[model samples]
Target chain A: MKQRLVSPVRMVWLLGALLIVCILASFTLGHYPVPLGQLLGILGSRLGLPIEVSWTPQMETAVWNIRLPRVLMSVLVGACLAGAGASYQGIFQNPMASPDILGASAGAGFGAALSILIGLSSVGIMVAAFAASLATVALVFTVSRHAKGDRVLGLVLSGIMVSSLFQSATSFIKLVADPNNKLPQITYWLMGSLSGAKWSEIGFILPPMLAGLIPLLLMRWQLNVVTMGDDEARAMGVNAPRIRLWTVLCSTLVTAAAVSVSGMIGWVGLVIPHMTRRLLGADYRCLMPGSMLGGGIFLLVVDNVSRNATTAGIPIGILTAFIGAPFFLWLITGKGDHYEH
Target chain B: MSIEVSHLSFSYGQRQVLHDISFQVRQGEFLSILGPNGVGKSTLFRCVLGLLSGYTGQVLIHGTDARSFSVREAAKHIAYIPQSSRPIFNYSVSNIVLMGRSGSLSTFQTPSKADEERCAWALEKVGIPHLARRCYHRLSGGEQQLVLIARALVQDAPILMLDEPTANLDFGNQLLVLEQAKSLTRDGYTVIQTTHHPEQSYLFSDRILALQNGRILTQGAPSQVLTEQTMAQLYGAAVTVVSLYQDKVRVCVPKHITIQEEAK
Candidate 1:
């Protein structure tokens, strides 16, 4: 047990293997069940390998159109949320910080709700959400700049203020929405789902997600020092303000991208980093990558269960809380002394 | 001089925290700033470390204006060990110490193998090599202080500034931390520290600077600066400065404690 606790590299490798298995399982276990052998052939054939085409045309269409996009979105969004969550925790030096701390998710939700009220296309909703989320964080930063004392506290308070501002705007949109059509659409979007994942949406969100994740991954070491607090980080030559600005900007970028595409998926960003911290100590160097991989595996499995648990598809945001909260409680309770409140 | 502060003053809006304070510390000198809580010792150190700006006067580290240097360049000249704060996350001792090399590394770079070796060497030097892989939060206060000192060691700066390095330790642990700091001064690092205890200044510091309301009240060799009158004025309590071990050491006792003993 201690051996497992000590070796984060090995655990990361294990998570990597588990993710590959989950992706393969998620591919085969969806609504239109494709067998493992034919699934491999389809994937291989798509990659230009000369594999025999024994799968049906509908099966291929299901694999390409529905399963592939959802699978990739789950993995990509999970990694992005978890990575951004870990970065937020590090830069803020607050364990409670998540990707939503800066109002990105709330802002994105409002954007989607407003776009839906205006009857925008699916892509238009994603774009509007992306824009609104960025704007919300920008407003938070501007407000916090004028706040007196403690930059971290200022950012957090303004974030709460702006987030609730946008949330009320979303509620107002819901109140005014057509009860027969737009209200339920807004409610379901707020709860979040991956059922509508499309190849085009994936193509649009992927670049920004990578753009956010790469800089955060590269700056993991700096993230570790930032956790020591601003004065200490600066004293150690880490340039705390610059690192903070970059972290907020990047974390906000990834979070906005994730929320715009997947709606307000909650618990992954909040709990996944904590889970990874328990598995691989709190060094962001390992914690960043670990949370990324762990998040991907978790969401993929959760997404699979959400789709396959019953005849009707459950909104993933609800399931994430239903699944994540209990699991998180179990993790904290077992060897409860290890965690700080 | 390793560090020079001349006519330094700071205010937090309407409240003046520090008045004109001037001092110079030479390389290889252990200068202890002695004061009670809220006397602005920490604020003074912050000014010296370039963590604070908008002061009235100049702070020079190695004869260069502190404000001109970037955080990295300032760190290269002087490393700081803050009070042993309980961190939110539990990083390993080695990992915590290895962060000392961050100033030398680029923004995108992590610690190299050489940096790892240097961290190990610092832990060994601080006599906590066994705790390298142990979680930092689980360590005793004394051990944590040592870990921070080791971190400062790995920073490889010529000057080390500690903000009350022993404020929260037990009696034996306090000596342990002070001795480690004194040893660093012997290794030719300029050490400046703040503390409320005059005995700590007497035992470890080559010179003592006493502060009252953020202004320099007195400064000189420990014997001259820590007299009974100065101690009483600084703490607002009568204290008897006692010489020990053939005048080689001294300690202060509150007058009431001595009176109570005599009554007993």
Candidate 2:
């Protein structure tokens, strides 16, 4: 079927422009608002520009210290998670595959909770989460390697088993944690938030995120060949297993990095890629970048609503589901057979 | 020989699927492999294509051992059209055809503009230029088979291996797909295919290799290899072979249906 949607090129430009607008508008939101001009002036001053500081110190602090890191974290985490999700979906040949399909998010959540109970520093918690996430994926692979039948199905099943294992471990930690301090912290962390965004945390996730994202972006075309299935891939001279390994490694790296910092922001990874596919079609050359931009825009808008919709900021994880589910439903049911082909 | 398999044998764990199968296809020849289900036709193709590495024998493609070649090098020697199945994602027809150029691309490389134009040319050559922008999964069974042929054509290999290209197609589409494959042999392409219909081999193939239980039951020209007794032994059914068009065409008709009708 010929898709009548906006062309892939223009849709990419549209998503990019929308992401920029959302990022700018997010700076204007929150408990302490920074107007657009002062935001630009603050950015210019930071960039060694000759713009005068006509705004107050609090606006500067809000734009530079508070909002900048949080905005960047949201965009990066959003892009990484959604990009990972899209890659996972392609490599696994399952539309239901997501960034968290291989237990990364659950393992990271457990790691963060365990560290919170141990009273570790925030950086330690991030490191612990990252390690635990990777460990979970490694364990899944080892387990699947031993299992018989289809390797992809084996990996997916092992992912489910291991993810639930970690989920129960986190629950046990929650049960034994100190109710007043560690309990609330763990619970809030599990719910997910970008409120604690810091420059150091950004630095920590950046290298791994770039390491993960750059390869995925570069290998997007190969991802298309891989979706034709393993036997077909091998016959066509695209090394399916090697491509699958690299894809899993890179996507897992990105997922682990995003989850370590952002707690458990869930729906953006799973839903944003599908939404981008609806708009841009299933070509990964476009879908990869499209998911990144669509995810950044989606999560940025959700984060804006999270921090600004109420006097007490809502946790982003909650807002993502609240907003993401309905919007995704509308995209699916409202459209006339967008995915039917 | 364009392709040769020497004493190729494969097994899964304790059970062997293909047992010392041997065959050859000469240059510009259309060879049809006929067999029933579970006869290891697909396993043989996989062995030849290097998808199965544990097989015991050598598959030489144009004097080079098929196993010695890397995946890309294998693609240069042979193009494959796998059985048509619905893919998870609905890729555009042009995009699916474009993937045939992937053997020439590096790990991080995409199909260039030249590759895209070649993809278009292959589409035109396959007579599916009108469906270039259509979704692959939305096409009819025959149309999907043609799209896959277009993809194989884009690979630009001298030898083509098709695994039951007409399995799920209607009668007209079956003839259409077989016609396309048969015509390619005229253009100096070595085409090897597997089929369930014995009559199709009679009509289109230069040689027939019949398999029974992973063993070569018979091989040669269709007339000699497709007698009533051989057909019955191969498929374990009562059948009769008859000539048509003043002995120019031959067909196998199962006798059980007529006997049951006469009894009724």
Candidate 3:
């Protein structure tokens, strides 16, 4: 008999409810502690509903300007990264694969570091990072094309080599920067914090994220065939190489955009997809959306903790690693067979 | 003819694998390719599938040039089943079978109600309708082979090509898979398979093609092609052919080298 824990429809409904609850709770439970009634009143007033203006302008700014943008960015970036990771895992047919498996993160890091060293504006840095990430994947694809046997294995090996190449370039940029000003900026950016997130930056990320993610959603079912290995997929009349190329391109675009905005947040991409697979089956129709929602909630909760945990906001990259590593260890030790087919 | 190949030759950068191979398969015929390891059986299959290019050959499927057909177009006429291996993901059996319909599906379109009905029919035809909802990876080897056969059956192609269908099966399971292949021929499907077992070819195949040293050594009816002399020449070992049950069953047994030396 098939062992199903929860039907996919029910799982989707449950995740949607949890996401809504998490968003509302995050808006209310920050350091400033806006009351729920006032929060609703503020929203209701903006929507032109008759509600009392019980909150001060400072509370209004904190909710709308400060907290809302960060929270929204958290959800968007989280969904993009996790969705891209799931797509990569399917294309490569490896559960261990993530968004950065093909050096997207490393390439973006190098681009951001170089831009910061040359005194580029904030927007310039992000644009450079996004471009470099795509460039890195293109380079990796070219190298793999020259490799003779086993195309998937070739891509993975070349990805590792290209990643190291970009990482060293990033290190070189960090070495020559001014220590007090430019070095600290570069280091903090690499460490990843959402403290200074703004509506404009969120606007910058949305288009590319959608451009990459929408195709992934549409091709979700096709991903099942691609993951079945190349020969089988070819026998099914799928252009395996072409589908793989499209998947990689879309995944790289979204992952690069997310990393450029958030500055190298880890673990959400790698862990959320596995967690989703364990809850739902490996059907990408369910796995893709499940990972997106799961990643959003995970990052939102983590960002909430980062802001409220102390006076100085902890770097999100550190916190994700702090939480992600232990959780991954537990999953490995307790439920290793869940990953094995 | 369902499939016709003439003077097919292939090489891997100066290392020749298949040399001057020519054969024709008629409608509803079961052709068994018998060869030792590294005798270019798989390479020949790849060439037929249009997976390997730069081969000197003329392969026609239903009087259409195979080389001119795109991969998808070729798939409409011929379906391929690789040897069954454990998949990395535990997808449902129905989902696995539905992938066979991909050749006919338009881009961005999900499987429709008709496609689902076809998948159901395939599972029923294979006599494993109960396994449709079960995880594919949990099935046994024989069951997995049957599932793959059903997957091919769902392709709706007239010609089916299998690579070592019973390569990993045990004795009884091997017979089970072979019987399934044999049954497909009776349904007007042209089935071609590569196998190492000569007795299986004798029992189920309408024709046998023996390959040795990257060349065809013999090609004819099983009775004419699978003689004791040809069997010994193909394997480079002494073998004896025996018949039983009023000469209705044929088997090949290899002579023991140690016993022969002691007697000498």
User: Chain A alone, TM-score for each of the models?
Assistant: 0.96, 0.96, 0.95
- CAPRI quality band, candidate 1: medium
How accurate locally is residue B37 in candidate 2, as Cα lDDT from 0 to 100? 95
Which whole-number lDDT from 0 to 100 does residue B66 have in model 1?
94
Candidate 2 Cα deviation (angstroms), residue B120: 1.1
Considering only chain B, report the TM-score of each candidate against the true chain B: 0.96, 0.95, 0.95
Best by lDDT: 1
State the DockQ of every prediction.
0.59, 0.65, 0.46
TM-score of 3: 0.95
Task: Chain A only: give the TM-score of model 1.
Answer: 0.96
Residues A4-116, model 1: lDDT tens digits? 44487777888899999999888778568888899998888998999888989888989888898999999999999999999998888888788999899989999999999
* Best-to-worst TM-score order: 2, 1, 3
Q: What lDDT tens digits, residue by residue, belong to model 2 across residues B1-264?
A: 998899998998898898888888999999999989999999898889888889998899999998899999998888999878577876888889988999889989989999999989888877888988888877899999998988888888999999999889999999999999998899999999999988888899999999999989999988887788789888987876878997568877779776786799
| CAPRI rating of model 2 | medium
TM-score of each: 0.96, 0.96, 0.95
Stretches of candidate 2 exceeding 4 Å from the true structure = A330-341, B256-264
Clashes of each: 0, 0, 0
Stretch of 10 with least lDDT, candidate 2 chain A: A332-341
lDDT of 2 by residue, A234-286 (tens): 77889988999999999999999999999999888889888888878888989
